[model samples]
Target: MKKNKKNFETKFWAGFEAGNPFEASDALFDFAHLDYYKRNLTQAVIYSFKEEICSNNTPSEIFIFYKAIGSFLKIYYSLHKKSSKWKVKEPVRTEDVFHLTSLTKEEYDNPFTVFQKAFAETAFKDFEFFLAEIINLSLSPCKEDWNIDLMSPYIHLIKMLDAGELMRERGLEKIKK
Candidate 1:
C-alpha cells in the first residue's frame, strides 16, 4: 500500500514538472483521497507551491500549477473546517514560501513582474472562488461534493491571456534585436 502511495505521489510530481495539468490533477485527486494528518496535508501544499515557483516554467504552465494548488487548498481547507480534531496554531503563510520584494520601474517591465501581476489579478480570483466554494460545500452531507475541479472557462481565459503576454514579450525582444 505504501509503495503504491509513493508511486501515486511520484506521478503527481512528474506530471507537475511536465506541465500536464490533467495528469497532475487526476493524481492529486487520488492522493488527496488517502488518509492524511492535517499537518502533512498542509505541508504538501506549501512545499508544492514553493517548488513550483522556484522552477522555471512558461506562464501557462504556472497558471496550471496555480490551479492545482488551488484545488489542493480546497480539500485542505474543507478538511480543516469540517473537523475539530486538530488545529494548526501557526499555518504556513504564503509569504513564507513566496518571497516578494519591492521592484523598481525597470524591474516591473520584466517577465517575472508580468507573472506577478497576472497572479495578483487572475490566480487570486481563482483562489477566492475556490475558498468560497469550499465553504459552501462543507455543509453538504456528501464527501464527494467537496471535490471541486479548478479547471474551467476562467482558466482557459487566463491561459489565453498568458499566451498573449508571451507573444508581446517575444515581439519586444525581436524589436530589441
Candidate 2:
C-alpha cells in the first residue's frame, strides 16, 4: 500500500535500458505478473526442476515441495496490490498467477504433483528470484534482452539446493588451483 522503500520500478526499467536486468540491485521480484514470462519461462522452469530432482529424488519427492511453493506465491501476489505504488507494465489479476502448479494459495499440493516435489525440497529464496528472472525474460519489452532461457535459471538453481554443495563445488574449484 505504501510506496516501496525504493523506487524499484524506475530502477528496473533503467537497468533494462542499460542492459542486464538481473544485474541491478533495485529490481523487484515482480516476474509472475508478466504475460511473456508465463508463456515462456513456465516450461523452462519445469524442465530445470525435473533435471535437478532426477539424481537424488524419487519422482514422488516433489509432492512435499508443493506446500512451500503455495505459501510463497501468496506472499508474492499480495505484494502487488492495485494500490501499491510500484509501476506496472501489465496489470495482474488473481487469475494471472494461476498454473497447474498453483491450485490455490492456501491449498496443499498432491503428493505426486510435479511442482510440489521440486519446490518442497528446494530453497525458497533462490527459487523465488529464479522465478522472477524467468518472468522478466518472458516479459522483456523489446529485443536485445538477456539471452536467459526459462530453463537456464534452474540449472544454476539445482546446483544451489545446498549451500555446502555450492561452496564446495565452486569454492573448492576456485581454490583448487
Candidate 3:
C-alpha cells in the first residue's frame, strides 16, 4: 500500500511536470484514497497545491476552488449530520472552516453541485467582495502556507484602481518596478 501510494505520487507529479492537466484527476483520486486520520495538515497542502502550484491560471484556479470546495466542505459537513463522531461547534457557518464531514464518500458524489449550493447559500456581499478581491483583483485571501502572498499587490492595485491612479496606461511593466 505504501509503495503504491508513493508510486501514485510520483506518477502524478511526473504528469504535473509534463503539463498535463488530466493527471490532476489521478492525483485527486490518489489524494482521496488517503486515510483521513493520517491526513492532518497535509490536507491543506494538497488543497493549496490544487489551488495554486499546480495551476498557472488564476480564474481557472478560482473556478476549480469554487467548484470543488463544496465537496471539500462536505468533508467537514457530514460530522453534523447526526451520525458522526464530531459536532458543530459554531452556529455561524463560514466558508474557510467548519466542523462537519471528513472527506467521506458521500461528499464526493457531486462536488460541483455542492459548490453551486455553497455559492448560492452565501450572502451576496461576502461572495461579491471575495470575488472582486480574489478574482477580479487577483488576491490570495484564502491563504495556506504552501502558497505565495498575493494580498500586497492586490491591495496596491485595487487602491490604484479605485483612485484612478493605475500605471498600466503608462506601461504594463511599471507595476512591478
Candidate 4:
C-alpha cells in the first residue's frame, strides 16, 4: 500500500511535469479514493486550474504547482474528515459570533449558498470574491450556526490566506525600499 501510494505520487508529478494536466488530474482522482464531497473539491481545483492558471497563460511550472495543490486539498480534506471520527459536537450559533441588527433575505442566504455552487459551477469570475466567500463561510457574522470541528479545514484555509496576505504586503513594502 505504501509503495502504491508512493508510485501514485510519482506518476502524478511525472504527468504534471510532462505538461499533461488532464492525465495528472485523472491519476490523482483514481488513486485518491475520493468520496462525493472530496470529488467536488477536486472539481473546484481543476476548474480553477483551467480557468485561472491556464487562461492566464502562466508558465508550466506555475500551472503544475497549482494542479498539485488542487489534488493536495482534495486529499487533505478527505483525511481530515476521516480523522474527525465523526464526533458529534454542538454547533456554535451565529449569534455567538455576531449581533446582527438586521439583514435582508439575500444577505441571510448568501453565506449558506456561497460554497454550494463553488465546486459545481464555474461561473464565479471573481477569484478573490470566491476565496473571501469561502473564508467568510468559516467565520461567523454571516451564518446562523458554526461547527468548529467540521469547519476546521476552512479555518485553516483562512489562516493560510491571512499569512500569505501579510507576506505579500510585506514583500511589496520591501520592493518600494
Candidate 5:
C-alpha cells in the first residue's frame, strides 16, 4: 500500500512538472493524494505571502499584499459565485476587498496599520470564512467524486500568484538599487 501510494505521488509530481493537468488530476483521486497537493500548494502560497509580502516595508507593500490576497478572494468567489455557501452579494474586486481607499493617509502609509484595520472589519471576517470553506472543500475525502470542478482553478491561481510574487520580488530588488 505504501509503495502504491509513493508511486501515485511520483506520478502526480511528474504530471505536475510536465504541466499535464489531466494526468495530475488522475493521480489525485485519493484522500492522501489530494491532501499532499493541497498541503504543499497552500503552504507555498501562504509562506510566500508571509515572508515576501508581509515582511516588506516598502511604500507599496500594502498594495502588493492586497493585490495578492484580493486576487485569491476574487478568483475563489468568482469560481464559486453561484454555489458558494458564503454568498457575497457583490463581486469581489481586488481594490474593494480591503476597503483601502477609505483609509486615512497615516493608515495608508503603514502596511501593518492597514492590515490591523482590515483584519478588524467584517469583510475580513467574511474572507476568513470563505477561505476556510475553500480549504475544507479542497481536502474533502470525496472531492474526486464531486461534480463541481474546484482543483483546476485553484492550481491555476496558485501558479499565477507565484508568478506575481516573483515579479514583485524582482521589482522590489530594483527599487532597492
Candidate 6:
C-alpha cells in the first residue's frame, strides 16, 4: 500500500487553556495534537470547577475529571497518528467526534464512556454549557453505570501538565499549600 503524503502536523483546535477559555488573537484557533488536546481538556475541567459550577470540589472529584479527559485523549491518539506539533489551523460535524456510543464492554470501558457521552453532548454547546456538564459529572460520576476500571496513565500526564503550569504561574508553595 502506498502511504499517502500530505501535511497533517498542523491540525488546529480552539486553543482552550486554564483560567481563560480562548486565546486573544485574530488567528483564533490553536493547533491540535496530543499535548494541546490534553491541555485543552484539562483547562476545560479546570474551567468547570473553578468558580461557577462549584468551588468546594474534593480532590477525588477533580481526579475523576482529569481521568476522563485523559481517556478521551487516548482515544484521539489511537485514531490519529499525526505527530504532535503546535501551529495554527475543523470541518467534520460534531457527531463524528462523539462516535463511541456503540462500543461494547471489550472495546470501551466505564467511567470513560460516561465522560465521553457527557463531552459529546456538551462539546457544541459553548464553554459555559460544556463546563457545566463536566463539573456535574466530576462531582458525581455514576460509577455504577460502567463496569470497567476508571484509571489511565494519561491522568498522570495531565496532572504533570497542570502542576507544571501551576508551578510556573503560582510557584511551588501555592501548589503544595
TM per candidate: 0.22, 0.24, 0.22, 0.24, 0.25, 0.21
The reply for model 2, stretches above 4 Å from the true place, is 1-4, 7-10, 14-34, 46-101, 105-124, 128-177
The model with the greatest lDDT is 1
- Itemize residue pairs with steric clashes in candidate 2: 37-138, 61-117, 62-116, 62-117, 63-117, 65-116, 65-120, 66-116
- Sorting all predicted structures by TM-score, with the top scorer first, yields 5, 4, 2, 1, 3, 6
Report clashes for each candidate as comma-separated counts. Answer: 0, 8, 9, 0, 0, 0
Looking at model 1, the pairs that clash are none
* Model 2, CA-based lDDT: 0.32
lDDT string, candidate 3, 1-177, tens digits:
333211212232223321222233333334343223123223333444343432334445444433232222222122112122222122132342222232223323222233334434443334334333344223343544424344433232222121111111111111121
Q: For model 6, where is the 10-residue window of minimal lDDT?
A: 20-29
* Candidate 4 residue lDDT tens string, 1-177: 333231223234444332222244345444433232233333333443332322223345343433444444343333223322322122234443222222223423232122223322332223334443333342232332422232334333333222222222222111121
Please state every model's RMSD to the true fold in angstroms: 19.2, 18.9, 20.8, 18.2, 20.1, 17.4
* Tens-digit per-residue lDDT, 40-107, candidate 5: 44643343323232232453433333333443344323322222222112222334324223334453
In what order do the candidates fall by lDDT, top score first? 1, 5, 6, 4, 2, 3
lDDT of each: 0.35, 0.32, 0.29, 0.32, 0.34, 0.33
TM-score between model 6 and native = 0.21
What is residue 117's positional error in candidate 4, in angstroms?
Answer: 18
The true-versus-predicted C-alpha distance at residue 142 of model 5, in Å, is 7.0
User: What tens digits encode model 1's per-residue C-alpha lDDT throughout 1-177?
Assistant: 333211113323335332222334345544443222122323323333332322323434334444444544433333223223322222233233221122333332333333334355555557557434433333233334225454442343333233222222232221221
Q: 1-177 in candidate 6: lDDT tens per residue?
A: 975433212212222322211121111122223355355455545544344333344565444444434333333332222212211111123233233333334223222233334334333223333434554544453422433222232243343233222222221111121
Instruction: Please give the distance, in angstroms, between residue 68's alpha carbon in candidate 6 and its true position after superposition.
Output: 13
Clashing pairs in 4: none
Q: Which residue pairs clash in candidate 3? A: 75-101, 75-102, 75-103, 76-100, 76-101, 77-100, 77-101, 78-101, 79-100
